[model samples]
Target: MTNGDDEGAAGARNRTVAVDGETFVYRRFGGTGSETVPPLVLLQHFRGNLDSWDPALLDVLAADREVIAVDLRGVGESTGRVRDNVTDMARDTIAFTAALGLRQIDVLGFSLGGHIAQELALLRPRLVRRLVLAGTAPRGGPDFHNWSDDLFDTSCLDNPTAETFISLFFSGSTDSVKSAWAYLARAGARTGDQDSATTLEVRDAQLQALMEWAIPDSSKLERLAAITQPTLVACGDNDTMMRTSNSNLLADRIPGAQLRIYPDSGHGFLNQYPVAFGEHVRKFLGQ
Candidate 1:
């Protein structure tokens, strides 16, 4: 583990923690100022590794809080097979945090990560101080776990072409297009010791989890009431994958949850409006 004031997402060095003999690789950024505040743990979207995160957003959030981003088991530099269910993934996250000796934390999960985040909070309520879910929704919602062919066509492979990513994440607007390119550039800017892409086996496992998560028999929506933590639900108005309406569902189900929808943006709205979204997160956490 590289220590001592490593700066932004790009500057932070990778570290590992052994959880039940499996090594979990993650990065820690901006824990310098105070001990009163808990670290913010970020959960990535479907098929995302650590490098898939937006560096601009990470830097912005790290300004006020320590940020920890990790590759789940079998993804990127982490070891072990990817779990085939969200519950197991949540268990892994709990184990990872336990190994780090963190008693309390803030969670920000996006898309599939959001699903896992909900599971984590439900599975171990006291561990999470605050919750943020972006571009995601409660289980059993219409279109939940339904992936567009284009989306999988782009992300299911080891390496997605630039055009495929743009189509999957961004809207067609001129501003969205410009931001898409910029976000991709920043996400890829880290030069040394890059992580390997998601493997086909891992992707299959994740997809299976998503499919099972979407089953409506025992809806997680009903369980959202159990998640009494202060929550923030956000998404782009035009999010193609996870419909923006699901954001409303999340806010309505989780008591005291707040909602935000960026105008005319898509799945990657946070990247398009990083400064604004960053400020929102800071204010939410500060409260």
Candidate 2:
């Protein structure tokens, strides 16, 4: 990836890396990490792209280390078929980092991106130094096979408006709703040279992967034990998407993993409490 001149996430321009005949678009912001800190690879949530990341969170996390968020294969400006399974998606992420010559890096994955992060750590343990799993669950995690009957109902929609995000990612509390709006306002700051909107095809492909991962199978939970790197499992106390208990399960299953749950928040806890969470992460990874 070419060096970016912009200083923050909102101003960071796009960069590309061609690997395996496919071009992947990514944004690398923040200056180099201080001391031994490595670059942090950010994985976007489901139906989200490079631009979908919360700028405030990125800016805070980048205060001490470089941050790189990439559009998943076949999503945003990236070119390729969207993989229908999390494992293949993880492989694509591996290829993207390998092409960039990243031998070892820290990772922060949100929602579906967290699923990919877990897979990445397990797929190539030595490649990742530290991990942060936000608003996500392990395979066969809580509420498995019962996410919601209308999951695809929203999936097929062409526009996921601000309200849609609020309903799904935020809690019903008055303060949480206000936080949602604030996060939305910050997220909209990036305008020029923006990444492409997520298409229905990419949505459906990721949905299929989610369904496959949500299938009822107790054996799948055991796979998380393979993750050997230092990890932080985080989410809101009222996560309707992945369920709060799932984050607890992830903390339990992953050896020596730390768990943090923000009260009065929902799936978008990191965005809601970006400052606290960002510092939490900075401290965790800095160690």
Q: Which candidate is the best by lDDT?
A: 2
Pairs that collide, model 2: none
For model 2, residues 1-287, the per-residue Cα lDDT tens digits are 32544568888889999968999999887867533678899998888988778888888898877898999789999999888899999999999999988888899999889999999999999989999999998888758456565654543568888877788888878999999999888888777769998898898899888878878677998998899899999999998888899999999999999999999998889989988999999999988
Candidate number of the best TM-score:
2
TM-score of each: 0.94, 0.95
- Candidate 2 off by > 4 Å: 1-4, 150-152
Could you tell me the lDDT of residue 260 within candidate 2? 93
Candidate 1 lDDT by residue in tens digits, 1-287: 32323668876778889987889889888755244578899998888898888888888888867899988888888999999998999999999999988889999999899999999999999999999999987888766565677666676767668887787778888989999999888888899757778888788998898888877643657898999999999999988887888888889999999999999798888888888898899889889
Clashes of each: 0, 0
Model 1 TM-score, 2 decimals: 0.94
